[model samples]
Target: MPAASASSARSNSALSGSRCHDRLRTFHERLQSGWRMSAPLELFSYWRSSAAYRVRIGLNIKALAYVTHPVHLVRDGGEQHAAAYAQLNPQQLVPTLRHGAVVVPQSLAILEYLEEAFPDSARLLPAAPFERARVRALAQAIACDVHPLNNLRVMQLLEREWQRDAAQRLHWTQHWMQQGFAALELQLANALHTASFCHGDTPGLADCVLIPQLYNARRFEVDLAPYPTLQRIEQACLALPAFDAARPEMQIDAVV
Candidate 1:
C-alpha cells in the first residue's frame, strides 16, 4: 500500500477513537450532573399494583423526578402482556424502571438500585450490615411471603383453574395476610429497633414494603384489629408526604 493511503487510514481510525472518547466523557458529565443521557427515569407501572406502589414510595422518598408509563393491569386483558413491555421485562411485571439505556425490573431490586445510584439522596437502607439485613428480612416477610400469594395472577389462577368464588378468594387473601401480619406484628412489637417506623424513627425499605401490603389488607377488609403494631406503623408512614403521595389513589392512572 502507498504510504499516504496508510497514513490517511490511521488518521481516520484515530479520529473515530477520539470521537468515542468524547461521547463517553459527555455521558459521564451528564450523569455526574444528575441529568440522564437521553431521558429521565421512566417507570412502567399499574396504579393499583402493590409492587408498583412500593417503587413509587421509594422514588418519592428519594425525591427523584421520574415519568410514569401506566400499564393497565386489568384493562383489555392486561397491557403488561404486550410485546413491547415484555421486551423491557420478560416477567411482564409492572414497576419496570428505565433509566437512560438501563432497564431494571422487580420492586426491591429497583429500590436497592436507587439507594446505590443516588447515595447522596435519602437512604432506604441502614448503614450497618445487621440493620440492613434486619430491614430486608422485614421487607421480604411482606413482599415475598405474603404479597405473592395474593397477587393478581394467583387470584386469576384460583378463579380460572380451581373455580374459587369471590367469597373464597377474599378468604384466601385475608388468611395469608393474617398469618404474615401476625408474625410481623410480633417481630415489630418486640424488636428493640422498632421506633416510630419499622426499623427506626424514619421510614425505610421495610416501611415501603409494609404499607402496600397494608393497603391490600384494607381493600380486602382484613381484620386489622389483631395487628395493633402494624396499624400504628401504617399511620406513622401515611403521615409522611412521601408515603401519602405514593398511594394508589394519588397516581394519575388511578381509576375512580
Candidate 2:
C-alpha cells in the first residue's frame, strides 16, 4: 500500500476499535444501568451546511449508524420550506436527527443528545465539569458566534432583502468569520487545555464543531494564517476516520 493508504487503513482500524469499545461499554450500561442505547437513527441534512456537518462528525465519533436524508438547500427554491420537512423540523433546518420516535433539531443539541443517548461512546465532552465547560465554550465560540452570521437564510436575506450583490455577501461572510476566528485563535494560543485537539489530546465536542467552521471559513476566503494552533488541530482531526468520513464532500448528496 502507498503511504497515504497505509495511514488511512490505520485510521480506519482505530475508528473500528473505538466503535467496538463503545459497543461493549453500551452493553455494560444496558445491563448494569437502565439506559437504552440502541435505536434506529435518521439524520436530515444538507451536504454543504456546516451545522449539519458538526452533527455528522458527532454521530460518526459515537460510532452510531444513521440513515441520511439529503435536503438540497439550493434546489427547488429550498426544500426545507416544504410542509413535509417542516413537520419534522419546525425551523426547517438541515440537521434534524431522528432516533426512533424522538426527534432532535439543532446541531449542538444533537451533539449533546448523542453523548447522552450513547454514553459509552468515545466521550464528546470530558467527565470533569470544568474541562467540560471549557470544551463547550470553545465549541460555542465557533458554532454560535462564527456560524450564525453566515447562515444560508441570513445570506439570502442579505441578497434579496437588502439588495446586496455577491461581493457584498462574500465580504459579510469573511468579516464575521475573521472576527470569530481571531477570538478563538487567542483563546487556543493562551489556554492551558489546548492540546492535540481543542480540549485535550483526543478529539471531542469542540473539535466536532470547529472543524466544520474551518470548512466554512475556507469557503468564504477567511485568512487563517494567524491561527497556527487552530490549523494544527484541524489537520490532526482531518487525519482521523471519524472526521474524514463526515466531511461535506464525502456525503452521498454532494455535487461536483
- The Cα error of candidate 2 at residue 244, in Å, is 0.6
* Worst-scoring 10-residue span by lDDT in model 2: 30-39
Pairs clashing in candidate 1?
A: none
Model 2 misplacement above 4 A: 1-38
Pairs with backbone N, CA or C atoms under 3 Å apart (clashes), candidate 2: none
Per-residue C-alpha lDDT of model 1 across residues 1-256, encoded as one tens digit per residue? 8999999999999999999999999999767656442468999999999999999999999998899999999889999999998998999988899988789999999999889878888999999999999999999999999999999999999999999999999999999999999999999996899999999988999999999999999999998998999999999999999999999999999996
What TM-score number comes out for model 2?
A: 0.86
TM-score of 1: 0.87
Q: Write the per-residue lDDT of candidate 2 for residues 1-256, one digit (tens) a residue.
A: 9999999999999999999999999989676444244567899999999999999999888898889999988899988989999999999888999887789999999999889878878899999999999999999998888888999999999999999999999999998998898898899985898989998889999999999999988888888998898899999999999999999999999985
Among these predictions, the greatest TM-score belongs to: 1
